[model samples]
Target: MKLHTPKTLPYIPVAPGALPILGHFAKMKNNQVAFLEETQKKLGPLFWLNAGFGQWTVVVTGEAAHTVMKNKETRSDVMGGEGDRITGHITTDTVSIKDGAPHRRIRGAIQSPFTPKGLTVSEIGALLEETAEKRTSGWKENTKLEILHETSVYALDIIFRMLGVADLDLPLWRKTYNDFVGPWTMIPFNFPGSPRWRSLKARDWMDKEFQKMIDQARATGDTKTMLGAIVHGTDEEGQGLEPKELFANLRILGLAGHETTAATVAWMFIHMGATPELWEEIREEAVAADSPPTSPKDMERFPKIEALFREVLRLYPVINVLTPRRVEEPIEIYGVKIPKDTSVSASLLSLSRDANLYPNPETLSLERWTKQAHRPKPSEAVQFGGGPHFCLGYHLAVFEGVVYTTIAARRLASLGLQPVLQGEIPKPTYMPLTRPPAEAKILLKPNYKA
Candidate 1:
């Protein structure tokens, strides 16, 4: 493999502070976004900052972001090296950190479960109904609830069942998974028996469980479900995936399928709750459609509802920062040549909020999407990311989003439910790192019955 060498680019300097050894570690340890924004204000979009030691991080936005995310030459090297420091905390051999042919093979193996052709439409509809029923039971009249945790549980349960991990230990898995993966976003250290340590343990447990599942499936001679497919799948050489690779890929698909979708669903409720008029409009639109609440085809036709979702992702993307990319070859970005081995990131938070791409970017407008809805192709929104590394489970995420939103909107419309926002939803403190607040609450009141 040809390695690109580092070349000096026009330097956009961040604020000069911190001791030589500490760098900006203190500020970053406290609040990453505040640190980034402070630097951006001081240094501009292409600024460089010292993360620690001699390590430097280049933060890019707007067109620069579009370039970084789509730059095939850069490869997803950061995910390979450092991502394991995070993802490995949850599960090992995750596809996110795998490269080249290995990545392709793992993703291909699991693709069937999420694709439209994979599951029968009737099966999907039934799953959605089961999920909605499970979710709606917790919602009370004029109640205040945190949607993220609820949606996460619903999504996890659905994914777990779909993957055929029905009898696995739930509480132990949840605690271990969260403990290991969650902290990695905030800090990279892994002390023994710590959350990271426990995460490792959980991962090992999952690995054994996955192997047992595969073994049982092999014994039964079934390749119908996702777990069975992975176990029974063969490469061009006609060899099945090794135990480690199978476990890793399964963990990656399972966790990625749930976490990001749950976060986006949380953001959806927060957005809808904050905007009463838009919420009511969506409610009315869903009620007017009068189709089965969980039908994907009918959900696809609800432009306003779709627009509302698009706008929410625009304002508050779930994965705020694109995982780091390493330059594989020399590339010019905004007239500066970035050499190989340079660590770079695209801020989806900054890109989605760009005023040029999104006029009056701070204000939420559902119609903005509706007016441009006729355009053929994906929107500029990088919430699902772009290029080869784009989310494999994109359709599944959208399916859940549509189903959950449709159910909420229809219920609210029928009872004329109005959500009373208490205060501003908390911004992510760790840039793209943190999850929705555990205590964040929204109150709902039913007014006019449809």
Candidate 2:
């Protein structure tokens, strides 16, 4: 496959203080948000930065984000050699990552399950309620547990149930998921102990497990779960996903369904812990609803909970930036000409925090979402992104967030427990997806429920 394109418009301008060989890799690893913010401040909305092996043009504004996310010219399929290697090892044929006809076909087959119409609200709510109750109860009142780790486990259970893999080991599945996805943003290192090495091994284990489930689903003609849906699904053309395609796309669903949602749930906890009033609001809403939300459609009934989730996404997008898009032909973003095959991406993190669009952007204002007039304009708070490639599990993720957050908040409140931050706010790991810092612990305080 072709790797190089004709030289792009004089490369997008690089951020200042980029070291010669390593470039901005260190800064990127150290703190991606601050690095991108500083660069955007100095270089304006669209600029380039050296990220170890090469340079990538970063787009920050809604307009530029729209340009890159929507333009079919900037296709969303895999890059040549490296992309092949990564997808080959981890995700072989994910529909969302595909660019052309294959993407559309595969996406069509899988899209139904994620849409509001297809999702079984009772099943989703039951799984989330079960998982949250089981996991949080394990944490004794007033104890501290790493929110990310706990939520990851919770997300895994809910997603696995969605895939009809309810019999799998939760802890092992969670670890494998983490290992496989941890290296997506790491420097390409193939050493025995490297992140890439661990990731590949983890993917192999997880792939075999999913393969077994797929085989069973096909054998049994089980159409209840997503895996069963894909196993027996067809596109408008009556083309079904091939086995390899099935494996890859299922892997994508598993990864995307859980990891990002887990991160969002974790951040929701962090934010709620900091603002007790928000948790109170969520609890009050839950009480008024008379029952916990059980499905994506049911979540619509809980506007306050939905609003809080929206605010959390706006403040801490699980994906700080949309997937990178390589220009197929020359394109102009913010009047700056980016030449053919130039690697480009848009930072959703930056856009969500745009003060011009979201006044007092840094503050966590749940009211901004609840009060119709204060909500961001379309594409302004791009938590799930926009255009053709917006997050496939957008609705499912929101439902999961509302269910998990509402349950957890109520559980804590019932225990007379309040969420309190024990240390400095964690700096998120902003690659692959934005993950909360493990060290940013939350402690439960008793008897402050108002």
- List TM-score per model, in order: 0.84, 0.90
Q: What Cα-based lDDT does every candidate model obtain? A: 0.65, 0.71
Give lDDT tens digits, candidate 1, residues 346-445.
8777777778878998888887877873631344558777766777776667767777777776666555566655689766433234346655667777
The residue pairs that clash in candidate 2, if any, are 121-295
What candidate 2 gets wrong by more than 4 Å, as runs, is 1-8, 20-22, 58-60, 78-88, 184-194, 373-381
Which predicted model would earn the best lDDT? 2
Roughly what TM-score does model 2 have, to 2 decimal places?
A: 0.90
